[model samples]
Target: MEVTTNTQVNERELWGGGAKPFSASYGKIMMWFFIVSDALTFTGFLVSYGFSRFKNINSWPIADEVFTHFPFLHGIDAPMYYVALMTFILIFSSVTMVLAVDAGHHMNKSKVTFYMLLTIIGGAIFVGSQAWEWKNFIKGEYGALETKGGQILQFVNLENDKRISIQDFAIGINSERKTHKSNIGLWYQNEKTLPKITVEEVKKGFLANPNLTIRTEQISENGQKTLLSRDEAIYKIDDATGVVEGANLIHNEYGNRLFADFFFFITGFHGFHVFSGVVINIIIFFNVILGTYEKRGHYEMVEKVGLYWHFVDLVWVFVFTFFYLV
Candidate 1:
């Protein structure tokens, strides 16, 4: 009877005996532990993000302004739309992964395969969308000016608060400027090169051309350097633009070098993570097509990669919040 009781207890425990049952395998448990550790690591990243926010409390950029582009809604000021779409795509992939796991439990290889494929396709789409977003970010919509002091000053076309670029400010009939020759010493021929229009000249033309004006020094500097304030705007000639001067960092408009350094470092790190996630997803996707996991009777590999994908998404959430939104 004791032996019978022991056997029954073991069977029950192995199947569904208690809350603290030790029936799960070492591999699955380790995966859960690893996920926990990874969660902590992400938390660390977010905490650091918070620290930076605190440090730059006054100068942080607005996420909404920075990421206002939609997939097709050109000229519309809809912010967070694409990011929301990407978030949904990731969540949907997670659902498909869970469905794949269910199919695996039922021993339905075909259904599991289909769901896995869908998950991969969704991930590919998300990565593609991310690439698009990155392209826009790198190209920048409204370029800013960098100061000699490494500070960014953005120009607003006085009539509109929307940011303007050096190209935008260019006005009528200035003779095309000659490029500075690198080997001026070797080529002594005073080739009658057309005189280049000075930034000062460009500024004067811009002032004369009612379409442009100087952005107030007090108007810009909220991290983004994208927005301009017409209220504080001055009609006075800018020393730099003479035509119209505003401060900004794009095109080294801000003289501050640290702005460029920080911009590249932070964005580059995030972009690298996105690139790595794409490569990893591609590997898992091919594995799904090859039916490798079906033979193994489990698609836990998908689950692992899914965790990583979710992590990248989560990090972007914070980055968007801090860098763009906040």
Candidate 2:
């Protein structure tokens, strides 16, 4: 007889008998595999974002300035406050999901239903808040002038040192302004909606206002935008090619265009995940009400969805740290 090898023994331990590896069922094992692969996908996205951000460290938009808006708190500078709240809501929803899973384990249908409802409510609020944030971001608060080199220049009041909106200072010129359509322009090209004011009008307004100064996109050592002197401001204003009113794939009044691109792609991807989770959670919630899992002698479905929910919440934590805090 031949001596037993380690590889043969390991194979026997793994597959020779009808034994559950790690005592996990087939569905649970498959879910873990899916989560591991999904985690790698998010990791790749965040790594790409980090590299791009480091490359444009000087000109990357400050999260505090960009995310200052809060619900029902117009004109207030609440930087990162609302984002913190959203994070709390999501984390709490994860907690409720855990409770739901625990109730499912004990076959407590009423408890599972209650916690599942809470989780769904929290997720819905988060999705709604994200939508509102996107609306504000797309409808940018302050407009800026973009140079041929794709640099953005904002305006500020020299006296009070407060940020100024292009709409607040841009003069209305009596000129025929029309959207560029494919019929009038290139057959395959169509221009985005034109800003209310043109660069020429903005130049005139800046020249007329002596108290206005220009703030470059470059971040200073003190973590503030570099403000130009009156003469320097006027000189830079001459280089203005177009007026950028909001964030889009092409232009961003905030700062670097790449920031907007990554923001849309990564956040939109995560938001889709949240929306899908909410829908699946609703389906599971109804199933719990109908006692489907109870008849099956186990609540493994709730546990599986709970795993996915926790993964989504965990991914958001890293995302928030990267996009908002960092």
lDDT of 1 by residue, 182-242 (tens): 4664665554332233555455555565655444323244443433333223333342431
Q: What digit string (tens of lDDT, one per residue) describes model 2 on residues 212-249?
A: 99999898999888999999999898889999988999
For every model shown, the clashing-pair count is 26, 0
- Pick by lDDT: which candidate is best? 2
Q: Against the hidden reference, what TM-scores do the models get?
A: 0.67, 0.92
- What is the lDDT for 38 in model 1? 59
The TM-score measured for candidate 1 stands at 0.67
- Give the range where candidate 1 is weakest over 10 consecutive residues by summed lDDT: 241-250
